[model samples]
Target: MSGKSGASEISLKQSLRKIEYPSSAKDALNKIVDLICGRITSIKNMDLALDLMAEFVFLEIDRRGHKRGFPLTPLIELQLIELLYEYFNNMSNESARNTVFLSIFSGTTAIMRLGVLTKLVSVAIAIPSATILSSASAWMQQLGNTSQNSCKLAEGLIQDYFYFYNPNTSSINLVPSISPQFTANFLTAVTENYFNFTKRECIFPPKVLMESVTTWVSENPGLCIAAQQKQAVLPPGAIAMEATTPIAGLLRWTVLAPINKQDSQVYGDLHLALLNSIIEIPKVTPPKAIYAQHLTGPINPILSYVNDLRNKQELKLDQILNEDNLQLALDRYAQAIQVIYSVNAVYGHVDDLFHQLKLLPFNKLMSIVISTYKKNKVIIL
Candidate 1:
């Protein structure tokens, strides 16, 4: 859901004067963030308030286009956030900040204060191979050229956190601990060039804004963030919908648990039983997701047996999977994929599907795209 693109081209920032923040508006049409921030009901409301705040922010930014220069709007954003801190501390209600709000446009504003929604927006508007870092040096130079004071102000505010809070600093140094001035320079380039963002070009902020929630929990002193821990995940008469596809449960465990050739044998056998069970059922098959429920309850413990054998490297696995088990497992996995994947559409040239696939993977599965187009040749006709 929060994936990124492969490449993108930057362009000019939009010249439109008013930002169309999504749906809810926090303040009056003439209001700025500072005006209503102090009047918020409670921290719980403040958390819910972010959705509305995002609109105010976008609108204010949109309005700034008519001004003579960059506002270097650090004071503006900081004031809004500071208001948020007070709202959190004083709230009597039970809205959890971490669970409720992750910030507007996720990482879009990471050029400034981007939070989780930055990635969500990127996913929503994704174009392949899009990254903000690739051409940053030239981009920085362009920022220097914008020559607008308001743009400069926004840049200054934008870069400070990128300098400190950047999680992207794991290895490469894309952004040298930039100064507010340096950030201003970058923002100038962005707005002046009008951010020529291609479908592939997505802005990536260096951080995912999250508080150490456990710390928040401990520090809060009295109750918990979400309904004082009294909330239930499911109400009465609810059941978790069956999962049709493989979802990596835990990253570390998945990384450690690669499916290799040996495990494939065991994996193969389990699949067969599943397939056999499904084929025996009547005419119209159930949804793949619905079938998945059968996998967990009926087949999971069986697979868990193999999992243990594989993990402990028990010799018993060698005896069971080698002959009969392999055929059974392969049958099941194939059957499942067959039933599930068939529901999706497939279209391509009929003449040489194998050859085309051998030569070109689909764009959905690939970064670069190639298609043949007829052209006139100057060969002595």
Candidate 2:
């Protein structure tokens, strides 16, 4: 092992010598592949070498145009994909996984930054595993001090994961097992990024976001349940709104969008989870109520929309509604109630809404909402 390690180090050093700053894209990519394939025994050494190589690659690509500098031929993309697959499939060490994820993220981001649209699909399809996904999630959560390039790369990789993987099919079943913390961290990062990005840029393609959230909620039931419990104790106010708004947006988008049957089921599950969490926020107390009242300013518009929808003939109490429409209605109702709670205002008419909802024959959907409200009513301290 020592002899092999020593030889690998020598090979790596030699490979590094061949790479020049601002080198042509083709040369840089070749050197990167060689360094990654070098027989290094230490994962740490391998990670360090890959990080440096990825940084150099990004710099070189940035220095030159995509078509002229780093023309991503099919062969080159295939090589990068193979390298990523080998590293992710073989390495279980967290640091190693983190390193590889960052490296691949950098490489993919270069492709995106250069407007190389065609190659992105290959990269995305090549790199979706439990280890990579979880490690990337953890890395993203801790990137408070990272470079803009690193941040962009991380975001691009996550967006790719959602774009390429469908939640309802056999392919989704292949998603590797991630821990509860991993799920929570991943969801938090995505939600925060979604809000931040939308504020300054166009909304993330809703279809992609929908698919990703559906997959995540389907796979991470335990984490979702834990999140629900956590939200239950939050005093209704601006802080609660900050956390819940993105979740409610996700639920509302999925509920309203046109999706296939499988995704519809997945979205329904997510819808239920969000509703349960919204109901879990503890009733406001004292000074918090004062701040909450200020936040209630925006609730009126949402309430008006809800009342308009409530009077729709299709949504009548005795009418049998389509499953998708029912879920959509429930989601809207949940959003309005959530906003009201965030402001610490008493929604005296919610019981009437609940009664009408219960009168609908959709037992599965209404039962959960009814039970959640009843449980909240019983728990006065």
Candidate 3:
């Protein structure tokens, strides 16, 4: 084994050894395992580290027996799985939760930074005994730092898990996995915690993380391994095409759809102007429809903002939102979305933009408009 691979194995062993496995704890361990890995709970459960480890174990066992034609007697393997599950269950309750969460998150991050997941993935394919680690590594990749390498790893890993592609060998393997956002959340929280007391902005929950991942995958529409092997990278111009096209479509439809001749004033001319500004950037790919709903959802709060603004007739956005300035708050929220959309123009495909946009400077245009709005308390007349 390479030095790195040996270290990977040693780390995995150390992690497993950290939890106690008492003989009497088998029952509880088995229950938690079943719940986490075996479809016992369709709804609620914890993402305990032990649960992840057990999943790795059972998956490894099934993997070996399934493909290699090894005889894992159902009765014996089943009982072993059950017992192991119970052991992990009690392990979770041992006030070890604190130690476990930190260790798993931090360890996973280190493993990823060292590029260990690729080797772990290969081992899983060969022995099938390593499926546990292999699977965990997939989630582990998602939970890594948000650098260019990390984004590529997460995007490729997830596409591999969902679509099942072999990253190194350029082949396909079909296995299901977790949602992208959950993966991002784990990495983001842990990273933010680490950044505490630092002046550098936190990295988790990147404003464009999910959007960029999904958009790149959607626009390319190929298996993960193929892209990895070819080192396929798109130019920024193509990225811009993917980013704004959807928004352009939305804008075009709004224009052709005709003003509401009936309740004309409800949505009225203001939205038309907003939509027009958005559509002007022709190539922008709009957010995915589902996510777009989230971006636009804050708009609904503006109804109350509008009502309050009308009562107070105050257009000073900074002063208003700062002091129950509901309208300004909504605009600020919209402004954030607008910023994301504009930044999307650049990060549309480049990996490290996750950090770059956080540091995006030059708010000249936004500042000018905001200054005017605050000066006059512009309330759309």
Candidate 4:
């Protein structure tokens, strides 16, 4: 072995010596194997580790052949996966977290590449065992701060789990191993805890990671829209909303995300549709007591502002251009917009009076008059 490989092996050995495996024999054996496999990178070191692991496997088989107590490598593999899941929750140093994540992610994908996870394990456990880690890594790589090398490794694994594309069968099918949002929640956790990304930050996953959701949404467009409408009832910071469909979450997250780019125009229509389709807040059939009290607050403002505007419209051009009049006009316009939003929040049906107001000349004049007043007020002030 080269000097670096020898040093790595020595480091590996020192780390193993420090590990205090729990009293359970199976747990202890699995921990030792995990430590050995996770540390050795060189072929020479790997050969030694493999020999040691093989000897342990044979000894266990001999000792418990009739009892069926040989350790399940697949189960051990799942235990190793916990290290990754835990890292996302803890506020560890970024460099250390990335190193640990990349190490396990790369090792798992390498094992996956050899078909060891599928071919060695029984079919019942095979698919799910291979899928859980592989799918999680796919989302992490696509959404997290991953190296190009790590991304390439994750891409290969994603092909196996996201959509099982088979050349021999000439068929591509979505894998039922995991939901898009289940893995997406991992990203949300890591970004929130590890990266400190604020809720407003737009962390768009790579296109490959979103393919399954986008494909499903395309097929069930109506259902997706209905799901989003239900999602709208919950507050933006709602914990329950996370249980909704992944597309609904993504749509709300990317409410301000740009869809005008050349590559994104394809989704612009559906995105806009979902954006506009969310149900209005303060339900149309609110309790009479609440509506009566709340509605007046906004309705009173609209009445006052509209009457003020009518009085101004009758003023001479010179009077309308006065500094005080211009300021009042600007203030009232601002108040009008606020009340408009408030009224819409309460009675948001198409046939509602405010909804009809949007189609009338008054709404058009408000837009034109607000702009003109803002300009004239600037000069007067």
Candidate 5:
């Protein structure tokens, strides 16, 4: 199923990327949105439409870096919400719902690119919050098997669209034309709405929070860069697994390193816990993640070696994480994380997670617990 979805996604993105923008970027974007939204007949088609929208925006940004940002005119706003509404209304098709929601993440990344390029940043998404929230509520009421993925995606989409507070100026700089208090109140309302839905609170902090965290992580050599060491000989029939991103590199230490590596059941339990945490469900009734069980065996022994130096007290905190020792620990682990995340769909950029963790003065961890009503769970480091 995923293989077919991947092929379709690739084909759609390629088709869109190959188109030459003979006209202005705004005109091209308008035409593409119109064409894509007009063709939305089924839930699967929503993914294709979002893919086309994202790829065109990406291509525009690539061709002309920060030249002109696309404006979210009333027409385009209506078209986008209408397209999303189509998917939300027909979300009973579980497979299609899952596939299209993943596309929302990619679509969001494209919009965020536009957000950074624009001088008055909120031009990326100008849709009214009430329209989106009401549509979601209506969808939930109509469907018997309400798609939780839809809720997650919708909440994330709205949050990202309006996440434009500028901490440096102590004001809303994303859309300077609007009232700062209006934007702040809008965010507060959106946050409360989702808290009611998910039954846990998460702040849409200033965009500068993410920026500051990423920059700090990137600058710290010991934290971001992997260490150099002679490759260790793996046991017979074992292959290597490497971390793909700096964020994943950090997780290898903070989250994965301290675990009892010889235990597949422990990894399975960990995977299950993480899944339950994301879906905001009770731990005792957590959903099964068979993929994690399948991959944990190969990952165990290699991971056992990841903390050898630390176990011996030979390296400091940063020194242990600074090295690429977690290379074997990340690939399959990261893949498992992605699958579990997709299965029990949670919103927010995965990369932003590590930065948020870094933002804590003592590397404190924040857990959004379902048990907590209108509050976030904080774990001190």
Candidate 6:
């Protein structure tokens, strides 16, 4: 692992040296693609190599102010999509397959994190062809099985669309307006492809899915909020339902059927904290009509699952309030609270759930919670 990390760092440094500012993003993209392909063949740790390459490309785009010049031409977008497909198709080992999948995800995530994924989305919409969207759908379908790794891949794609396409954020204004119907269709397809893999047996613990859902909700607040809206007109036989039902079921199984008392307490507390945090965030006025419709079927169900768990007798708050476990529990609770605050900050809101700390009976727990709140308060401000 260390060797792979070292090699990936060296490759990133060398590839970054090839990029120059105030250059065409088109040409820079080509060079980076070549770098990624070259490293894939020679490197034992293809995942790290791909991740670094994607990160480098994202950073370069930011540094070069390429948002306006980004090659969104159908040909360029199609070529990148084809390259991704070819890489996935050619992989023969688990390592290679995982590498390619995660690398693409990491790359997409990098752009999204940098708030540049919306640039690509605008460019994609400029072209008449649905080839890029269709190609991504096909690639996701090819992931083969539902597991923790596959879940991550699905989340990555979902994150890309939700963040870039979401209306609540300023990023949505960067592109030409897309019809609500078009948004619905795209989300339906994305959800369908994601659920296809999620239906398979999972090898990891159920907590993994819970954590994944939590992370998704935290990171993509606009998407989650939009999903809660009513989409009055979905195409017949749309798969938008997949988003909510499966996620709700997953949460139910994970929360209600905990593997043990200790696990249940930990998960139960986290769920409660997450629920409280979500509720504490002040709501904003809905985005305009065109951007209002979202495929957030999972949000309500996940909330219900958490509420149900909170009502159950098994969730004894006092059990987890003891001195030995109090610190860990407070840490987890604070982390959940942080996710809510982070989302709020992005969307122009300020609310905290420190009031929820009263649920704990122990004074030490309250003190820890107060201290944690103060620490995060400084960070958020």
Q: Candidate 3 residues 86-110, lDDT tens each?
A: 3323343322322232233344344
Candidate 3: RMSD over Cα atoms?
Answer: 20.2
The TM-score that candidate 1 achieves is 0.23
> In model 4, which residue pairs have backbone atoms overlapping below 3 Å?
none
lDDT tens digits, residue span 1-381, model 1: 112211110111221113332212323211323222334434543443343344344333332334223432555444444443333333332222211222332223434443222222122112211122211212223222233332343344334333444534321122222222222233223332221222255232222211121122222221111111122122123232211111111111111112222233323332333334233323333322222222222133235445665677664644545433333333333344343223321122322322232232112211111121111112323
Q: Please, what are the lDDT tens digits per residue for candidate 4 over residues 1-381? A: 488867875665445445442213333344333453353444564454443233232222222224335544665545433432332335233333333333333443434322322221122122333333333333343333233333343334444543464322321223223333223332233222211123354245444444443444444433332322322121123232212223223332232222112125333443434333222223344411012121222233234434555586675534433434233323333343344344343222322433323332233345663455456557968
Sort by lDDT, best first: 2, 6, 4, 5, 3, 1
- Displacement of residue 68 (Cα, Å) in model 5 is 15
Regions of model 5 farther than 4 Å from truth:
1-24, 39-254, 257-381
Which numbered prediction scores highest in TM-score against the true structure?
2
Clashes of each: 43, 1, 21, 0, 2, 1
Give candidate 6's total backbone clashes.
1
Model 6, CA-based lDDT: 0.38
Q: How many backbone clashes does candidate 3 have?
A: 21
Q: Once superposed on the true structure, which residue ranges of model 4 sit more than 4 Å away at CA?
A: 1-126, 129-173, 176-203, 220-249, 252-254, 257-263, 269-381
lDDT at position 287, candidate 3: 29
Candidate of highest lDDT: 2
Q: Give the per-residue Cα lDDT of candidate 4 at 240.
A: 28
Tens-place lDDT per residue, model 5, 86-161, is 4333445332332333333333352453232221122223432322222222222222111342234334534444
Which wins on lDDT, candidate 4 or candidate 6? 6
lDDT of 2 by residue, 2-96 (tens): 78967875665456547553343335444444455445434655554554454444333232223345555656555554544454556655554
Residue 285 Cα positional deviation in candidate 5, in Å, after optimal superposition = 11
Candidate 2 clashes between residue pairs 3 or more apart in a chain or in different chains: 232-280
Better of 2 and 4 by TM-score: 2
Pairs that clash in candidate 6? 227-296
How many steric overlaps does candidate 4 have? 0
